[model samples]
Target: MATLILAQKATSLAYGPLVYAHYLQDHESDLTVTVEWQDVPEITVGGDKTNVVLRIGDIQVVGAANAVHELAIMSGHASQYTDVADQLPHWLDFTRNELASGDFKQLGQTFETLNRHLTLRSFLAGYTPTEADFAVWGALRANKIFGGNMKSGGAKLGPHLVRWFTYLNGLPCVAEALKGHQRAVESTRNRVDQGNFDIPLKDGALGKVVTRFPPEPSGYLHIGHAKAALLNQYFAQKYDGQLILRFDDTNPSKEKMEFEQSIVEDLRLLGVAADRTTHTSDYFDQLYQYALQLIEDGLAYVDDTDNATMREERGAGIASRRRDETVAENQRRFEEMTRGTDYGLTCCLRAKMSVDNPNKAMRDPVVYRCNVKDPHHIHGYKWKVYPTYDFACPVVDSLEGVTHALRTNEYRDRNPQYEWFFDALKIRPVHIWDFSRLNFVYTLLSKRKLQQLVDEGLVNGWDDPRFPTVRGIRRRGLTIEALKQYILMQGASQNILLLEWDKLWALNKKVIDPVAPRHTAITEQNLCVVNVLDCPALPEARDVPKHKKNPAVGIKKLYTSNTLCLEAEDAAELAVDEEITLMDWGNMIVKRVQRDPATNIVTQVDLALHLDGDVKKTKKKLTWLSMLTPAEEPGLVQCMLVDYDHLLTKKKLEEGDQWQDYVNPVTEFKTRALGDSNLHDLRQGDIIQLERRGYYICDRPSTTESPMVYLIRVPDGKAKSTAAKVNAPPNA
Candidate 1:
């Protein structure tokens, strides 16, 4: 067990003696910690209350809680400073007092009170890692000797707290004893966070890569987006190439500033910071100039055709009335476009391409449309015309010094137009690589479809866990490593294939399995009760390797009571008197089963835990929570489990399908769990696997203290589980 040493001067002040606690843990080969103490108090020996209080006041400078929980733990008292802290002090005080009095149940209630509604890395302070934050983490662990917010309180702060603890523990000489422990880890496949990979290409082949993830700021990122971001980041990093992140903010009607901010954050969370972030709006001037150049060269013209006329012209290869205008007149009309007079639905600049081309995208595509009323996100409406992507992308690529234009095959027919724009403008050429866009079997990756879901309120906003945006994926707990692996594994190939969602989930599991801490929880459901019947008093279990291969992550399990809850499903499968292995705990036999008839829910499960001789029996295996486990016995716990499905039901979504009709009714499920108090320390972006369930991310914390609602990545497509060992992508 790690030892904590406290140095203090005793006093009878209203808040008790001022004390400073220092946590000490050896930097053994198996553990590591580094702590930096800022502004340590100079030597001050004071027996009087006033003198000690002044010293404590100085300590506060180094220790303002970074967030609510952290602030409360350090200085919250019942009478005087209650208002300065959050509202949960009564519960926390009660729990702390009870734990002091050896009342385990009340202690659990206290943790629940303080833990409820806390957010992960949700900083109340200006920056992170404040003294209050560390103090609260330490207090929670200390207060945890009583029990935690698992049952009586519906919160589970253990995993998040533990993760936070681990991170802080690595902060450069954290705990004096744990200074060098993390440095001795077995593997350090650290990846580049910036730059593009410089891959050598053969003649006539694209050599340098210039990949861009053009996200329209319509909504927050989703999980699928994380995959794309990481993929682009990985290729750029591996080949020493440039990765450009462009905001495809063509449709300003739905885009928002919040989404723009979130996109930056999502990329940061994925660990691949873009080298250069460009906006589609940035090229408006050049795009307009190119359009004018096109008109002068007889390569484009003004199209006054209304929507219906333009539609028919595009459909039947019918030339619009203005297509026959003289080149000088067309150029004059284009100049009029820049003057912002002919605005809105009536006027547009169309490429003067063949009306009878085999490829429809080549038939007089509208290069610029007038938007007079729309206010630009960055630049307020200074001009009226906006460039279409087909025209703007290649133009911007040339101007931005982009080398290879990588896009999905959906733009295959538009490549010629891309080339045309480059040639007509007399700009340097850009190579194009058309790979098949990612298509998940049960999910939609279409930006248009996703936008509809956001607009129609079919799900919670853009970052809704069901969405495939990168922010959504990070919120769903999918790791950057997993996403990078999955994306690159697709290998910049042109072949189109529908990837199974299970593969995505499986990859996530592998990436998370190694480093995520192990925790345990039993839900409110009866079958998942925690009752320790045969375990020895004060049992000791190794803090399981957070990642079996990475020694830097180590989490000790928390155990309590004599009874634990099992999942209702697992309870149903257990036959009375049948034997099963209890995960890492060997084997056990079902002694009895109880159910609530009205709810048809399992009320309780009684198991005769097998010890010693019968541990090797192979009849079956099970995962059980032990009530006999003490506060120090770390274990895993059940939490709110959420599962997501695609919003659209059909394979190829119809233009007008009601997105709400296809909404998966069952998107989230709640279950009580038992895991280590360590979970409470997890940071906002940490990714880990919850045993039996898929991988999850520590999303923003919820009420009830435990970072509620771990973003889960359940299988989306049906793939039969196989015994075949799957090989992870390289560096995953």
Candidate 2:
């Protein structure tokens, strides 16, 4: 067995070799590796100041980068890809010289170069990972500058770079290595108290507590479902227990395999992994037998009550006429229903828990219903009758060994009904824990309503930014870290408060603000031209940091010339001979202003350079872009900026109110703008700030076929203007 020795306190520099070794152990069955931690100051076997040492038989390697190279060669990974093997030393040299030298300008340039290189490739070299990838990834991971930029939601990193980094980090080998190191460090610290807000489960024990996230495969998961899934995973992991992902596919009319697969993918995106997976249909036979057992015990009966009358009777606390039916007759009716006979189509199996209980949910709820129309997505047309959620949940929960049933408080009234199943069937009882349902103002959590919106073309699709679905918000720039942080901050509060979207978005802002690269854009409509009286005769290109606060984000080129363009609104606000500061340049005095006599819109302005003027004394610090000559056309990239409003005009839609009536007539607003030439290089899903125009995410990049680049405005947690202001043409 090969042994790898690492420092007791391993730094990020040690992650590369550790991950590589773990990967080899997982993938190569014949290879056995053991890892040991030592309290040595440093390993100097190869004259390198590293804490990582790898020994194989009589040969030893020192330093993380060196160990990775040696291991790749020894493991035969290098010889397989001889083309990429030569590039390993180049990346190693770059890591040692450029990355380790602490040169911000060179670091920024290197990040941009690497980002462009990864645009079309999965790894640094070839199709599979190589020593080049391991060395570069390790050095970047250990570098504080790269780590900080990534920590801020990768707002500073290019989209392709972020994607590549995320893919590597998500690998099981890499994740496990990092997590093991984190656990080792955390083990030395005192356990922090959760304070008074911690909700404890009855009879909960370490490794014994089992929680399940049961999502019906009727529609894509919304934010509400995300909360439930996360909370269940939280409790299960908190107690070192297991989490089971159970698909409650009881309603054949609505459930589909597509929805089931999407739910699974969404859960994975949310970092909620289940130890086991199951479906309610898995217990169909068992649940049917249990229902028959209840019938034999006189605890359930078959009812032929019409849907309307049954609902009215339940609301009025009235009993069904067949409540006194005999067990034999009920059994025969249930069998007929299972066979999908004519009379059976009208009948349903109802638990005899109660008929006139104050809690309506306990009023002999229907346990089994006939669904002869639509076949089950998975089971097919095997049976015409299917179990309802109320009946299948408790039965499956108990059968699956779920210790604590964590659900929303909306199901509190049904808690008693759920408990009655155990007593009626004489099965083991499971604890019921109810937390508050996540409710957002102006947001519809109902799958039916959201589906209606999609079907009616009220929005783009389920992933529309205006919609509150998990994919929707994510497309709108909500980071998984921000979403998880917000959900955890809410904790186990039972108070069902209607939350505003601002708070959640505010948290997202904090995650993206530090690293989001800054760019410039000016509205094309009513654009004002500015001619400098005394400026450079030729355009000069200067390199500047993309983010003023975060130099590690990289650099962008600024082209300066005598001609500049500003937003019409800014020009309209300026007066002749008034001194104003040009952002990123210097203060300038407005010498002349020209406007259209018809509409009083600023058309053109002339400014004289005032480099010695005090920029702080100017009231307006304006963002301006230099314009190219006639040969370069406009010298700016045309972009379309898209902003959205709430789908529903009303803050809270009440029961009995028509939601369609309150749909906002116009929810999307688009503005035409001219942006810096660098915007043309941006790919889809890149997040950037448009100087004075707030933040935007690239929905579509500019192409030769379509000259306009599409950008969607990202909402900050500030008070927004009304519909008029949002829809109005951009002046500011």
Candidate 3:
């Protein structure tokens, strides 16, 4: 082991090596790098302005361009620094030459390049955080300080770039560098300290870390929405910050008070309480005023560009003729849009960002749309024009004093556009954190597609057990604890993978399997009647624990009688004169078997109660139901057991695939069964498990038209097999 020396400034010039040094220092407990240091020379012998230089024994390197590059190459090869040393070179050249240019246009292009690179990644160069990220991020940070245009956060920076930049800056070491060691003085602006469980922030918000989870109340929330909610909840709790549940209900065409109220109920059911529930509708007047300010400042104009042609022009990088509309003319047309007249519907307010930017999102996107079909969910028909999500989100987030905005990476393209609004409105800028969108394979989580299933009568409704909505999964017997555990386990990762459903259901089993009460039900069709020749004349009832492994869960009753019932399938397997064990009862010997004359289906069986025989000797242990006559108290109840298959045939549906062609031919199946008397007391929405069958949720309790309890089969871990035609293979 030999000494390695670093002689560099803590300034932006040496920020690349500085960030990497900080990362190396953070992981010092896990690493072994002998090091030494020296002060920076007054001036470089060479013309290079780079601040960092390193020396390891015989090897010497100068400037960040060479020092950072050689640090990666030689450290891994000869000095044994870290594996990241090898890959840092690839990113250094790009950062030093391309990213460090400090040119506004090059910065935009650089942001676009970085945005595409970080689409589904957490780091710049590898699966784990590496020096490459620090090198590149350092250059970006330096640009932010020296480059005034970048500091203002215009439409030039892409969303993913901003997201990654924000995430890196949140790192403990990076944060220390950002805020400096000022004990008595601090900038009025906040440092963006928000991210995963591992990302550390100082003393929680108290009241400083204000955050919000904005949901558009157009449909019921699905599992994907749960991810967004839970992540926001995680950070809010992590920093002791306030989480506001703001309904982004700006579109009058889709939003309804019914949806608004349902969303409230759903969030409550999820066990997440917002510090306060607010709505984008709350800021309609303020947003309207902001729009006027944009026009008056020549940053926005009214465009009558047809929908199709506007898209074509955007793709072609062609400017709209309305781009040059005078401020007076634009405001006049905007006033018409607010009136909801025929011409108003055709006119839209567009931002004046760019018409030929390579990024299509910056190509003068629409800011407002006109509609007056129905009263707003909160405002009623008092106003006609509505701000687009792009315009409202950034504006309201800043207006509400939101310190950090958690956005799904799906909005990565329009990030620059969002910042443009924040700048044009001249409000406090909120930090943007983009996490990957949640996606599950073989499941449809889209509210729009789910709505189609409801409208087309393909599914029961939004709360149908087969659907992936929160209400649907709960209806299917998934516990809220299990749902939360499953989602949070995914962590704050940025990787977007199509997850399998088993992982989620498996978590549910951990929660429900322990506490869910146990009951009994025998198939109604082809039930076998057995005669216990030497049993007590009268039926005997005894109390039995619901869960054998968890006795504290309480108990249910079991009855034994001379005549009992068994599943026809179980009886068919029994041989005449062969002794078998009746679960909960002693061994019984099969004396005779009776069958239908034509079909040969087991119809009846005669057995002798051999109480002395060892139950362990029997290979066949059966779940039997004692015959309860119509005269028995709290009598047996007939019930329907239902199970379902995936809605789509493919494991992962591609964008080009037709939904109609992939719809499962048969998704639901039902069977009739006779449940124990105790089951009669079970009500709808109760989760229980049958002795020989699987877990179930009581979908419907006894009613005049439907007397039997309806038990919807809830999946354990494996996919259930159905006898009906299935698009997926058996057991899928």
Q: Sort by TM-score, best first: what order?
A: 3, 2, 1
Tell me the tens digit of each residue's lDDT in model 1 across 1-732: 111111222111111111112221221233222222212122133431121222222342211121223322333222233443453444344323543444666655644544442344442122443333444443443343523442334235454444554465454434432322233221121221121234333222233656677777877765546655665665666557788999977766667788899889877866768889989888777777777778878888887788887898789988888888999888777767767774434678888878989999889898887776778787777767778778888888888877766676878999998898777789998877665667764477666777776677777876776677775665676566777666656655566676555666677766666667654444444545634456555645445555556778864554434565576677777778787777766667678877778986777777676655375656565555654445543334335544444454544446697655655544444444544455655566666666665455665434356545453443422353211112222110
Kindly report which residue stretches of model 3 are placed more than 4 angstroms away from their true locations once superposed.
Answer: 1-196, 200-206, 629-632, 703-705, 719-732
A best-first ranking of the candidates according to their lDDT comes to 2, 3, 1
- CA lDDT, every prediction? 0.57, 0.85, 0.77
Error of 1 at 692 (Å): 4.6
The root-mean-square deviation over C-alpha atoms between each candidate and the true structure, in angstroms, is 25.5, 19.9, 19.6
TM-score of each: 0.60, 0.71, 0.71
Q: Better model by TM-score, 1 or 3?
A: 3
Per-residue lDDT tens digits for candidate 3, residues 476-498, read: 88888888877766767676778
